[model samples]
Target: MIQLIASDMDGTLLDADKKLPPQFPALLEELYRRDITLAIASGRSRTALLSLFGDLAEELIFICDNGACVMQPHDAPIFHNLPDQTIRDVLDLCDTMPDTIPVLCGFHHIYFPENADQAVENEIRRFYLDYHKVPYSALYQTKEPILKIALCNMHGTAAYTAPMIQERFGSQYEIPVSGDYWMDLMCKGITKGAAVQDLQKQLGITPAETMTFGDYENDISMMECAEYSYAMANAPEHVQKYAKHIAPANTENGVVRTICEVLGIHMDSLRKSV
Candidate 1:
């Protein structure tokens, strides 16, 4: 039986517009009735996730900031903070890199440049809720635990910023290209795959009992943690190579649809309950 399901948010669970489907809550209810645990794993912060999930937030597991932080239902989070010196070094790198925007992600807030371009601010708002616009030094000095150091390059992460960061910090950190525009530097051993393993250990679920869906480079590590892995139809060519199967596009509610089909949930019968 599939006891656990973990999915990446952007380009996998959320639609093209970056919004959750209207049917999510109802689907969550059905999954709960079946005793299936759902985990939402994303490079987003927990506070941002809470806003997106609303009242359902407490009921779901969140692998936030690309697994640097994890919060399970009714329990305290398992969180890892970047070393202070590492944070400073990354900050220095971002400050010197042209066209790169660095953001300090924490358990409670995200800190970025107050003087950042308007477009950057708009993009940041799409994923963060309790974000603050602060000077670089101010952000570096924050007291909150630092989950990850995020860098954005509108030109493309894999082709530009990620490679450089990897060359410089690869031995010390896992610099995963989060999306076309984002790269996240986490502690060397930290990854979504590791987070999933931890969850499996906690829930006593084997790899065979877990299913996961994702569509990006960071999601590749997550795919390795599950025996039943699915890459979205819309995923990039490189990303498609990792999964055991392929699901329809996220706009079609692929994750939810696949869950329903696998669990023998009849949508027509579920309409009233939904």
Candidate 2:
């Protein structure tokens, strides 16, 4: 019996347009009725996730900032922050990299360099709801800890910025290519898998009782943490290799579809109930 379900937002749960399927609300209600917890695991910030889900957001668990922060509904969030000196070093390094803008993710707001262009700001606003353009030095002075440092490369992080970042900081930090255009840097050992394991222990659930879905490399850790892990059919072959199952593409409402199929919830009944 699956007691928990965690799914990545961007390429797994949300469609290419970043919208949730129409049936998602109904599906969520059904899951809640059955007492199954659905956790949104994403590199997105908490505020961003909440905006996307609206009032429904309060009902789900969140593993935000690629698991640098974790929270259950109505509970104080837990954070894993890089050392202050490390954050300064990362910011300084990002300054020298062309086409890559570093975003300092804090508990309340994400910070961008004051000189970032409008195009990049527009793209970033899609994922981060609350943001400020400030001098990089201001990031180190924030009252809240910096949860993660994300490098945004519109041209594509994997082929460009990611390798450079990996080569420079891979051994010292937990850096993951979170999306086609984004790579995240965090404290070592902070991963979606670790967050999932924490939740499992808290809820008295085991890997066999947990199910997860993801579509990228950053999701691999959590993929390994579930007995019923699924990779979206749209995922790369390398990512698929880590999962136990293959879900339909996100465009096809894969997360909800797979949940219904594996848990025996008829879509017909779900639609009728809606």
Candidate 3:
């Protein structure tokens, strides 16, 4: 039997508005009742993640910043990567590429260079303000431990920022793309998939007994590793390439439908009554 279910946020779980569906909270409450472990596999920073999860934080575990940090409710973080010499290597790249805006994500806060442009500021607000204690124009040297570093095109010209990041930091970091405007660098050998392996071992479950859902390139590792993996119907082409199944779109309550099907809830019969 499947003992856990993990899903990505943005394009996978949350709708286009970046809001979780009302039904999902209810769904999770039921999952909790069954003693099933639920977790978010996301590219979001942990602070922003907590804000999004809010009161439900107790019921979930987090694989945050594309799996750079892992945490659970009322606990010290379970897994974290410390930035050492590599951090300086990444920062030096930022220094050389002045046009490429870099956002440094920490466990509890985010820091960007003081010279962040208007577009960068707006993007930060849109993505991080709700959850993070943001420190703008604040990165001094690469001395602090960072979860992930984001690189975005200043001119908004790099069509494939994912590959571009690989060309730049591929040797030292694993660069994964979550969307058109963002590419995240996490330490090598660490990813949502790796985190799942860790979580599974702790829970006494095997990967074959797990299922996952995601809709971004960053999610591909988990999707490829899980025995049963799904991509949203609205997922990007690159995302779909890795998933074993294609589920309904998010707007249509696709996740709920899949859960009901897997758990043997008769959604069709109930829907007719409603």
Candidate 4:
């Protein structure tokens, strides 16, 4: 029996407009009634997730910042910060790359260099709720720990930026292409998969009892941690290769639809009159 269900946000749970499914509340309630835990895992921050989940925030498990931080409602959060020197290393690397906007993710807020393009700030704010514009060098001085360092390229990630970062820092950091335009870095062992493993131990559930859905490279780790892993039909070729099954597109409410199927809820039968 599935005890835990986890899904990525951007390309798996949320639609292209970054909106959640309309029937999500009802679906979540049903899952809770069945004693199943819902884990929302994403590269987004806890604050951003709370804003997105609203009333449901306290009821779900959050694996945020690409698993650099994990928080369960009413409990202290577990966090992993990139070493100060590592943060500096990423900043230095960003400096050498033109048109690359670096975002220093912290538990409290996301930070951007004062010189960041206005467009970049707009993009980051779309998913990150608490954020600031500060001198990049000052990041090393902040007392708050750093979660992950992200670089955004308006054109695309897979072409140039992702490769450059991987070649330079892949050995020391976990560099994952988060979306079409962003690549994020954290300490080598920090990943959504690792976070899921931690959560499994804490909840006393095994991989067979977990179900996961994802649509991007960053989500591959979490997909690996669940036996019921599903790749969105709209996911990239690489992403689809890692998952165990395929679901409908995110726009079609694929994640929820799959959950309903797993729980034996027939949509067609429900719509029939008595």
Question: Which numbered prediction scores highest in TM-score against the true structure?
Answer: 1
Rank ordering of all candidates by TM-score, starting from the highest: 1, 2, 4, 3
Q: Kindly report which residue stretches of model 2 are placed more than 4 angstroms away from their true locations once superposed.
A: none
Candidate 4, superposed: residue stretches over 4 Å from native: 266-274
Which residue window of length 10 is worst by lDDT in model 2? Answer: 135-144
Note the Cα lDDT for every prediction shown: 0.88, 0.90, 0.76, 0.87
Please provide, for model 2 over 1-274, each residue's C-alpha lDDT reduced to its tens digit, 9 standing for 90 to 100: 9999999999899998999977788899988999999999999988898889998987899999999999888788899877888888877788788789999898888889888888888889878978989876776676677899989989899988988888889998889888888899999999998999999999999999999999999999999999999999999999999999999999998998999999898898777766
| Residue-level lDDT tens digits of model 4 in 1-274 | 9999999998889987999987787777777888999999999987899899998988999999999999998999999999888877777887898778888888888888888777877888888878888887776677788888888888787786887789989898899999988989988899999989998998999999999999999999988999999999999988999999999999898998898898786655433411
lDDT of 2: 0.90
The residue pairs in collision within model 1 are none
Which runs of model 3 end up more than 4 angstroms from their true locations? 130-138, 142-144, 154-164, 266-274
- What TM-score does structure 1 among the candidates reach? 0.96
Instruction: Work out the TM-score per prediction.
Output: 0.96, 0.95, 0.87, 0.94
**Model 3, position 255: C-alpha lDDT score:** 70
Q: By TM-score, is 1 or 4 better? A: 1
Cα displacement (angstroms), candidate 3, residue 193, comes to: 0.6
Sliding window of 10 residues with minimal summed lDDT for model 3: 129-138
